[model samples]
Target chain A: MESVILQIAARHMRPLLVILSLVVLYRGHNEPGGGFIGGLMLGAAYILFAMGFGVQKTQKSIPVSPVILTGIGLLLALASGLIAVLMGHVFMTGEWTTLFSGTSFELKLGTPLLFDLGVYFTVAGMLMLVMFSIMEE
Target chain B: MLVLPILLPLFFMVVLIFTRRWLAFQQIFSLLATVILTFFSAMLLIDVQQNGIATMQVGSWIAPYGITLVADLLSAIMLVTVAFIGVVIMIYSPGFIDKGRQSAGYYPLAFGLLMGVNGAFITGDIFNLYVWYEVMLTSSFVLIALGGSAEQLRGSIKYVTINFVASIFFVAAIGILYGLTGTLNMADLAYKLRTIDHIPYINSALMLFFIAFSIKSALFPFFFWLPASYHTPPIPITALFAGTLTKVGIYTMFRFYSLFIVENLVFWKTFIIVIAGLTMTIGVLMAASQYDIRKILSFHIISQVGYMVMGLGIFTVGGIAGAIYFTIHNMLSKTNTFLAGGLVYQRSGSYDLKHLGGLYKASPLLALLFFIPAMSLAGIPPLPGFFGKFFLIKGGFEAGDYVITGVAILVGLFTLFSMVKIWNEAYWKKEPENIKHGRVSRRAIAATSLLALAVILLGLFAGPVSQITLEAANQVVFPEMYINAVLGR
Candidate 1:
């Protein structure tokens, strides 16, 4: 019964770690952490999942394969900057638009943060992909 | 222009990570992305040629506050070269890497390396340059150590250790520079450096910075790590490193020398010239004895890097231009040579020249492709390689640095000898009984032939090519245009 309880705890830990990694990735722009460290943290989280769940099950859980994840990360980062051109701004020029009916906090989204997220995904995918391939070998 | 290079690659790296299942889709997207980047880089180059400079600020932060991506002719030229080679390499990697589970990591690391390379090129902030250098270095670490062979691991540890030490020194140099100049913006530092007189600590700071760059560039005493470790990686990865990584370091060195260090001219001039001569002589002598094709090519990286540095030492406009031209030619020729070697290894299953023979009999097209770059590398006339060397030698002679010119010419001959040696052993000689040749892959041949065609194209189009080079050269020499562009005059 204790063993079952421990298994349940382990099952809950994966999503918890993923959430923690996201927090770290998001807070990186202002404080001590940034995209690179955040990505590495996320990579480690995936590694833990793979270790606990086994490579096959972990592979099943992650929607995209590691290689594709890297590609996606790359595209995200590029798109963040490319949006400037769409707005008739210079390439990589940050375009921020304040969207609210009145003077109230709503949602803030800009290309730089978007670029940071792209970096996070790329580094995370790349590190784990490398780690997994090497470990498999 | 500045942010696009870094952010574009960053975006693609992310996209690649999540979309790993679609291998064909990923390849198509990566190629498409590279084409887009090439168009962007070409536009930047043309813009720089016509308008003089382009700059972009991140987060709408003013100069000295937010990170700036500045593209003078020099940076734009490098971006174009990088995009051209990167596109070719991306196309070529598919042919050589074989479909495998490991490709998931390979594609991302490739983009990551590109991310670092472009980042290092366009960054206007000195601290940001260090960050980009780390990006490039760490990505290279993963790429080189990917297979984790006993030899590869050994090579990686050494590579990482050396580069890590260099990174420490790099950061330390930045710290010292910031302390002295009170600014991390390169143009600001240049402005500050000029106003200060005989500053006792400034020369020492410059020396520290020089040491950091020299170590990264593998100049003379700093070069042992390169030949020791480069051969251990798989060939395509080695090709990437040989073609791009150290050249990034050299580019950084060129950028800084023209900007802040121009204050104390005589000191750096003498120091760089001495190192250039030694680097050329030592790299060639070592290449003469190496048996492995990759190792031989690795040594030539140092030798060829010396020619570029020699141009730096001469300190004339033409001399600097020569260095710029030589750098572009060397990047293409060296990468082409390495890729060809990879194909040979793929076919014959060994890179040892002694073990390689009878390849010419089995494959004539491969031999022809190999010969084009090899002869060009030897600086034979009508090749861009020849023109690259010609401009540098002319610059050196014009500067009346006859001794340096002599060294450059001698190195050219040795480069020929080494190329001929590979030709004799790997191509012309009969394959030993143990050596077996099979039908080489069409994809491998196709990729190599494409690069071979480029070497010829660069040769035939020397006029426009050199014009681009001269424009980059002028931008490096006169950086005010860059400063003004980034920080409104």
Candidate 2:
């Protein structure tokens, strides 16, 4: 019965939590929210869904396995570093470009943000993997 | 860039994690990754040999403010040695590591271990070194506990607890040093330390670093954890640990002593000499009593490390060169011995000397493969270990340190005695009536033979190798080149 109430609440809360996590991840470099916290928040949301809908269902909801997610995250982070080397800089040296220039503030993208995104995915995937394994046990 | 060696392994580790379910793919891919890494490291070594030193600042930050990766002759040599060992062990591991462990993330963790090791060897900042040490400790902790067996758990607990404490002390020292000097860049710190007046806090920081590194290197009075735990892991893991892990600690000691603590060696010289003497005598004496093959090898590691420290304690160019040479020889010899011991365990189904017998009659080829490294480890003539010991003793005599020199020669005899004990018990004794002999795999034998060949080659080419080590030693003695390379002077 408790699970049913949780399931109903989770159905609405999951999307909101995921969106908020994205917002946190996107604003991480300039604001208080960053990859680690955003990843943890995303993982927490999935864990809540799992608690309500069962681990197997939650696993099916995510297209990739959590461990694979971690691998992808690491690859992304490493690629960010490699990109700098290719640009004739040292490994992991951040390279920035103006994506969209504006009068007030430019939409700038850089390797550091990519690295943070990689960290976000890694942390989220690792926490989720740990949670799912423990729940299964 | 200087980061390729480290990054390659990390990338492979992540890929291995994704391919864990596909056993064949994981095996093949891991092997491929190791091969590529070996090539990359060799290239790096050659490049550094030609270019003096390679330094890269991560994220475009200047030296002293950013994390820098620097590969001098010492780091490049160590990197190549580590990569070579990684390749041989990776080849030997497929038949050795169980299928369950493989599927459960062995390859990924192994690569993670390599990543940590490479990172430690290349980092130019002290705090960054601490971070790399943590990375290494974490991966090693998982590798040791992979099976979750009772013995493994016991060993892993001890290993983790001791190393964790050591790391805490390491970080604390780094914090104090950073607070005092306002920099963590080793070259920058060297410059800063020279300009400042002697302070009591600097001595305290040095002492803290000494204790922390001593534990990691398994120096005397802090080495009990090594023998208690090293034999509990699987043979391949043990072999890898024997080759690479503790050496990182010793390397750090060499680096720190040469760069930061050289000015204050008068305060710590005798202390290091005494520790070296104790570490040598006690480690070999304990090895003589151990019945398990791996345990015996583990104790000798401490003994051999003592020899290297004795070189540093002597504090001369020849002494440091001898230490570097001995380090290279020991890394190969020790890993080969453990690999050969693993083969013995495989054939006899036991690591106990009492239960093992008659390997000589069963496998003469294996016997010879084992003999080369075993005797080399015992400082047999024409082998690398003999030259390493000779130079060290000569260095000791040159320094007029007769007492430690005598202790070193005495310790060498005991090391030979322990090696002979293994030969007598494992190869000469008659096989027990009920013992079953398993056929050793071709890959294991091939891997052992490859390392044995390396030992032989190093011995045969001692002149050129000695030259390289001499150059490396000179670099260690003078930190200006390292500083200039990193800071772009």
Candidate 3:
């Protein structure tokens, strides 16, 4: 017996929560939010969806396994570190680039951002894995 | 290059997480990774020998602020030993581990354990050491409980709870030490601590570190968890743990004591001497009473660790060199003994001595393999253990510590007696009539023989090995060289 109201609220809130998490992840390097917090928010959003719609429905929606996601995340982080080593610098020495240095709202990119993205995926995937396993039990 | 030893296994672990479904791939890939790591570590050892202590500041951050990976001679030798044991265990595992546990992420967890061990060996920051210890402990917890048997669970619970408390104590000490010194870089702490004149607080912090490491290293009163838990894991896992885990604790104790905590030598010396005597005597006496092969071997680990601590207690170059040499010998011998015990279990179908007999008749080759490490462990002449014990005893005599020298020699004799008891009960006695025996797996034979060969070579060539350990001892005693290397002075 699922609560219809809770389901409706979850349906309405998930997109917003996901978008907010992305915003947090994007601004993490310069602001208070970071990969771990953003990932937690993203995990919370999916967990909320699962809670309202049931784990089976959530699993059908996202067919990929969490373990694979964790693997990808770890590889990404490792690659980010190895990129520096390949360039003959120390491991994990951040490499930076500016996409539009002359513009007011310039886009900046770096290995640190890549590393954070890896952490985000790892945390989100790991939390969901734990949550779904517990929910199944 | 400094990161390769750590990063390689970590990468393999992540790769293993995905390849867990492919048993053959998992086995082959993990074995390849360990072999590569062993080569890399040996290369690193040689490089460090040439370069005079390799130091890497992570992410290009300068020392004293950033995380550092530093490998002096002590760290280099430890890394080489760990990687070698890891290779041996990987070779031993496919034949030893059951299929159920193999599919349950054993390879990943083993690599995780290696990552932590290597990280602990190389990290130059104190807080990072704590973090690496946590990494090691988490994986060990999983490995110990991998099978989910009642005994395994009970042992893991005891192991986890005690180690968790020790970790807490470790972090608390780190916190207090950080508070007092305002730095966590170990070399910087050494520098800062020398300038600070607060003896009482420093002594208190050192005591906390002593208690925490004592538990991890299985020192006298804190060693109950080791004997209770070690026999519960799979044979290969137990052998790996026997070879590496407690030695990490001892390594940290050696690192911190010789590097930063030597100023208060008087208190530590007397304290270590008392603990060493009690630990050696009590561990051997307890091993004499245990009938289980793994349990007896586990108890002897604690006893042998006492000799290392006794060397440290002596606080001289000869003493530390002895400790390092003993550590290397014990790591190989202990692992081999466990592997031999596993082989015996494979052949005889029981670890209980009362229910076992006639291994000598069943397999003369197995008896010889077991004898090499067992006698070597008992400090037989022309073996590595004898030289290790000799150095420690000689150091004790030179330091005017006759009492500990006496206790060490007595412990060695009892160790021999217990080894002989196993010989008498398991190897010499008649086989039980109804028991069926199986041939030991070739893989198991290969792994044990590799370690046995290493034992022989180390014994036959104790000169160069002792030279290396003496160099390590010199680096340990003189922290200034270590500080200069890590801090770029």
Candidate 4:
């Protein structure tokens, strides 16, 4: 009975933290939160998940290594910078547009925001990698 | 292709993360990627030389709205130089990084570091520069503390703490610059700075930027963290950090000094001149007293940085050109020397000069290999370091700063003295029986030898390289060209 309770407790926490991390990441553009803080929280989620599920099960749940995540983050980040050049702007110039065709409006993304997202993945991935290596020890 | 060099590594770094079981495969792939990067960077250099400036916009975004990656001649030359060092270090890593010591995370972090460095060189915005600096810093923190020894942890904590403080200051500087100019673009900032009257706020911002950069470059006052942290890492890691990391700080300093902040001839210039003189003397004095090989090398890093910064302080084309050339020459020589020292440490299980005597007896080729780079680092003639010093001194004289020129020459002599100390203690001295040392691996020796050979080759081929540096200097001296090129004006 105790084991079952512990398992249930562990099971819900991982997804909860990951979702929370994404929330923090999403609200980063104009809010107090940003990539570095949000990604660190996300990495903490991975560690909690791994601790509860064991390294093997955690590895299966997130099959991608932290390295690949970091690389992709790098790609995303550089892509954000290059997007400016494509728009006929100087390098790293922030490009933005708002979307409101009729009455409804939505906040459109820009390179700085994209850069933030890239940083999010990079920090998250790097933190996970470091934690994983420490666990191996 | 501009994005390809950066993106390919980004791609591979991701793939390697999942393929943790194939660590060896990841290493090979990353090395191949770097080689291709070097080639692409070379092509880009040629293109920029012929075409003026190569600007690329990702996802087809128009100007001022999207980020741009500009490869001016200056940036391209840095890219090539960085790639050259990356390839050599990659080649050397496999032999030096033992399997027991290797982690699934090392290669990816290294690639990530390369991405940060390359991105920093290529980006045209100040905010983006800060972003890349974080990228590089975070990866470096991981690499330094990877093994997680007590010393490594301590060193990393100090390194991270200082750098984190510096990064905060850097972000503040960027914010101030943006608020002042209303734009984050480098070319745009240059134009705004020229048009705006000299204000007190601008001077304060300049000082803020200078303090932040000084910490990053480990200039005299902010240099304590370097010796404390640098000597804690494994030798190859130390070699990479010593060669590349601080130099990036210096690169940014050169860029900003050349483009944005040229007005303060009396205050900033005089201040830097005094700091450079003190940095050189203090650094060499520290090096002369160190018993450990790594510590000595670490001190020399500070002294050489002084030379490069002195060129910037002079604010002449020749001086700046010399700084550029000296930076490249120092990167190669320092990396090679540190890597060779690593090989020696691996053989002896220690880095102390007392414990590492008579290395020449068991490994004559390794001794010879270390000797060449050491001499180059000492600024021996017919080598890259020699020309770097020559150009710097010439620039100093041309600027009519004869007093600083005299100090630079004296620093050069001290540099030779420290190099000879290493030579005499490590190679020429007799082996104490207990410290005779075990045999070094052939592969390690081979890697060091290759780097040594490259140093000599760079020295011999200084003419063409000097031309490239000179052109880069010209670009830096004339901010209008950079602004016009970037803005398509």
Candidate 5:
């Protein structure tokens, strides 16, 4: 169902799109790009792959089912909220910890980032699940 | 913590999701989770009763800025009621739902719906309420079509379409509200609304809210989707929804009405009264004509919701208290009636009353189980429904709304007639020829009996329960108390 040129383009675009989506997801804590946008990009990569390659081939490449990925994503998001409960803070209060603080290259991590990552996986998985189900059908 | 009722469901949702492959594990774990949810919800209610209103700021943020989870008496009561219903549904599901369906993410989806309902009940911010509504809708969209039956799928399409429209209206209203008040926190919005009395868009936003909540709660004009879609799902799922879903809309309506829009109080009260009258009259009249058990009960849900709204329209402490009590009573009895209908279907292999007969002779226990909730719903003396009606009517008369009170009284008669119609057709008549009976699960039957007992106890302890609801109503009727609790003003 696919042309050779289209297939070649999808093959290169898939990895690049995934890398861009991951970058978007990581920088989402402080910048404008966040889980939702990154998740869409990740999902778009799969959708592109599915369109170029056959549905069965794309299914074979996915390591886990989209449904399970959504479950894992929900768990991660819930765990991020639970962190505050554990620290004797209110539920969902963001707890930030500095990584490489004294160095010139310092990064900050927090539950908000974890929550964004969860949203990232959830949206990606949900999008893939819907798109794949439709395409396969 | 006040947040536990909302969080417990999410935790169980993940557990159920990972365990969806094992039906046995999912069932047991779900049951345990519902039990814990109920316990915690009851504890919250007790805490709210002992020490005034309880508010928890999510993530340790300030009340006006962050999402606040408030467990005032009203939310606490609703939490307990919803959680109790969840426990009953979890117990009832294992027996009613097939193994294949159970393994196909039923438990997880059910908990997802629960999480949404709990979140909706306790959220102190208006936008958070909308988010929870989406959560509930997403789970419901799947759950309604879970069986993959042709008719079920068809019904789900209508259900999904109608609810999405309601959500659009809801979100649009929120947009207007946020634009007008510059705040999303309900308490803060209420405080701001009092100072700005000249805004005309407030009515439009409120009208939008009324339409949205009315649709979600399935009031008279917007009720067609409920009876059409509710019967398509299996009995346990239908009963789960029958007990919890519409009440969320009603809860929000009460919350918003009691707290916001003080400038239009008289107008909203009159509008609510008119809607309440039409809703009850139309809803009961529709129920009187339905032959199918689930359809009858489904229509009855609309009528009973009218009673709650009527209580709201009465606009007194007694009236709102009555509405709260009526809500709790309806949750128990309505779910009980649906489960009893499921049992009838189990023993007779049909939901159509015309094809059903002689259950009184065949199973007196089932007959008794059906009788208790049915009579309670019909508002028989010494039942909670009677007291619910009593409170609402007394409050209505006190408020000098005799016409609506009369409508409420007459609706009671029609409600009784419908209950009697089912009683006669399903239990009193002889068994129809060629009827095939399936084995009824003892666990499901036990769950039904336990729910019926709750109805009975609600009546027996009406004195104490009413006292609590009245206190809750005091907070509901006064926005200052709620705002003070939330903002420490």
Candidate 6:
């Protein structure tokens, strides 16, 4: 934890890990990766930082408490499911629209994606919360 | 519509999580949510009763292919009973739960538990049922240890460890069943089990399920964890768990028993009957030896569960209906007894019956509140418990299972003896000198009275309630109807 090399390594690896996790999250709707794995990766990034900087520092750097983060995640997931109800579809039905389209390329978004994003936040926040609590002890 | 019962609590639980810092807001919002939940479940029961079984494929997927939620008469009844109990507990909790635990996510965890219970009641997929059990168990594990006292931590450790072992058994059984049948939809599995002539190790899988559910329901040998853990929490949490948790296991047992255990009936029938009798005799005998009021009631929960399983063992329309009815009565009365015990603790500053006395004079209303549920639990006339047992005993006699029928009746007497023991020690004995008295809040009393009122109403409306349960039992007894409802055949 005190080694300069390890600290320096953690700083650079965290951003790369976070970016890779985002890529995983974005590709999950139709592929192998999903929110759960992406969130775990993101949590691992935070874990690396905590290992280098200590839990108190990590807690201070985070914008909000983990409790609020988890709550917000649940709200987002519920909101995604509820949006379908507002759209007069069944609860949690995938309501999709193409965000961008071309002859050879297209991007689509749906409530399922929002649901996945919610899971990503929740899992990451919960993991950090547990890790921080255990580490602080 | 079917999704609402599960969704509403989950939505409200999230809201409560956000509002956890606001104790007053949490309490009021929780009461409001539980009231709405009760109304929704009541409407669900009414709708099902009027229209027959309700089925919904979530996300508009086909029943067998995607997740399905079904509310037959039995599930609806369970939903309604649990929702009503939720409302009562919400009302009781504010006065009983201290500020520390209240602010520490008590309300949110409660809703989480409610959501899980609702999910378990309605889910038509076996794997989804396991998921719901996890949700329910996780919330309960937290609630049981919220205060984190030495005693509570001890209780929670045993509770969590034993329950986790039971869950492992559940998953193992699910894996085996899925490998053999290739479907996790409950009705689909039931359909296949009936169609296929031979499936190796199916009975072993059934035994695994039996072990898992019996542990959950706290039947006989697996019940040791319940009495060990139930009394450690604050009385409100204990009250909530007493009312709804084990009953979910019983409900699932009934559901699975009706759907899947038809072929091995002869062997399993004798097996269940023996276990039921032992559960009743052992639980009551242990209860009779306890001086702590909470421990006595905790043991009684085990014994009462035995009655429901006894009816299950009988395996007739009358028997299943009686089991359902007994389940409803037990949930209401068990909670009432615990809440009343909380009130006793409020006034006496103790849960030890030896340290309590003269409550009948100290507060006549408290005495009456405890008396109502106590008598009902003891199977007195003009109470729902009587009819529940009467129907079970009648079914047993009808089916010529006379030995266990006699055992049930004797257990009923033993049950009365336990209740009378509590009454004498807590309400009738002379108060010891120099005892400090605490205030019993009017709100808590009123909340408890509401439960007592429910028990009385259940007794008064036993006719109609039994009619509904009989219809529910009919649905369970005839799995073809349920299979058709889920499979759309």
* DockQ of all candidate complexes: 0.40, 0.76, 0.75, 0.26, 0.85, 0.73
Q: List, residue by residue over B1-489, the lDDT tens digit for candidate 2.
A: 578888989989988887788999987898789889989998998898888989988888999899989999899899989989998898888878789987878899899889989999999999989988887887898789887789998999999999989988998999898888889999888877777777458988988999999999999999999998999988999999889999999999889888888456776788899999999999999999999999999999999999999998987889989999999999999999999998897888999999888889988887888899999999998999999999899989999988999999999999999999999999988877888778788888888999999999999999999898888988898888988888888
Error at B451, model 2, angstroms? 0.5
Docking quality tier of candidate 2?
medium
Alpha carbon lDDT of residue A89, candidate 5? 88
TM-score of chain B of each: 0.97, 0.98, 0.99, 0.97, 0.99, 0.99
Candidate 1 lDDT over residue span B11-79, tens digit each: 777767666667887878887888888888888788878876777776567787778788888888888
Mark the regions of model 3 whose C-alpha exceeds 4 Å error after superposition: A1-27, A30-33, A37-63, A125-137
- Model 4 captures what fraction of native contacts? 0.26
Q: What is the interface RMSD of each candidate, in Å?
A: 3.8, 0.9, 0.8, 5.8, 0.8, 1.0
DockQ-based ranking: 5, 2, 3, 6, 1, 4
Docking tier of model 5: it is high
Per-residue CA lDDT of model 3 for B1-489, tens digit only, reads 899888998899899998889999998898899999999999999998888999999999998999999999999999999999998998889988899999888998899899999999999999999999988998898899997889998999999999999998999999898887789999988877677775458777888998999999999999999999999988999999999999999999888987787576788889999999999999999999999999999999999999989988887888899999999999999999999999998898889999999989989999998999999999998989899899889889998999999999999999999999888888999988877677688998999999999999989999999999999999998889998888888
Colliding pairs, model 2: A93-B59
Candidate 4 C-alpha lDDT tens digits along B1-489: 677656756766766666656767866876787788889889999988888877765444543445667777778888888888778877778777766456537777777788888888888778888988987898898889887779899999999999998988898888887787778777777777887776448777777888888888989898988998999877878888887789889988878887788576688789988888888888988999998988999999999999999999887889988999999889889988899888878777788888767878877876888888888888898988999999999999999999888999998899899888888888789876777356676666766877788889889989988888888888887867887877778
Better of 2 and 5 by TM-score: 5
User: What DockQ does model 1 achieve?
Assistant: 0.40
Tens digit of per-residue lDDT, candidate 5, span B1-489: 888887789888987777778888888898899999999999989999999999988888897998888889999999999999998998888888888778878999999999999999999999999999999999998899996889998999999999999999999999998887789999988887877757667889989998999999998699999999999988999999999999999999999998875876788888899999999999999999999999999999999999999999988998999999999999999999999999998888999988999999989999999999999999997999999999999999999999999999999999999999999999999988888778999989988988999999999999999999999999999878889888877
Expressed as tens digits, the lDDT of each residue in B1-489 for candidate 6 is 899899899889888887788899998999999999999999999999999999988887787998999999999999999999999888888898899999988998899899999999999999999999998999999899997889999999999999999999999999999998899999999999999997888988989999999999999899999999999999989999999899999999999999999676889899999999999999999999999999999999999999999999999999999999999999999999999999999999999987889998888889999999999999998988898899899999998999999999999999999999999999998888876699997778988999999999999999999999999999999999899999999
Query: Candidate 1: which stretches are off by over 4 Å?
Result: A1-137, B198-200
Residue B74 lDDT in model 6? Answer: 98
TM value for model 2: 0.94
lDDT of 6 by residue, A61-137 (tens): 78877777777878888888889889998888889988657746687889989998888887888789778877986
Worst 10 residues of 4 chain B by lDDT: B57-66
Superposed Cα deviation of residue B13, candidate 2 (Å): 2.0
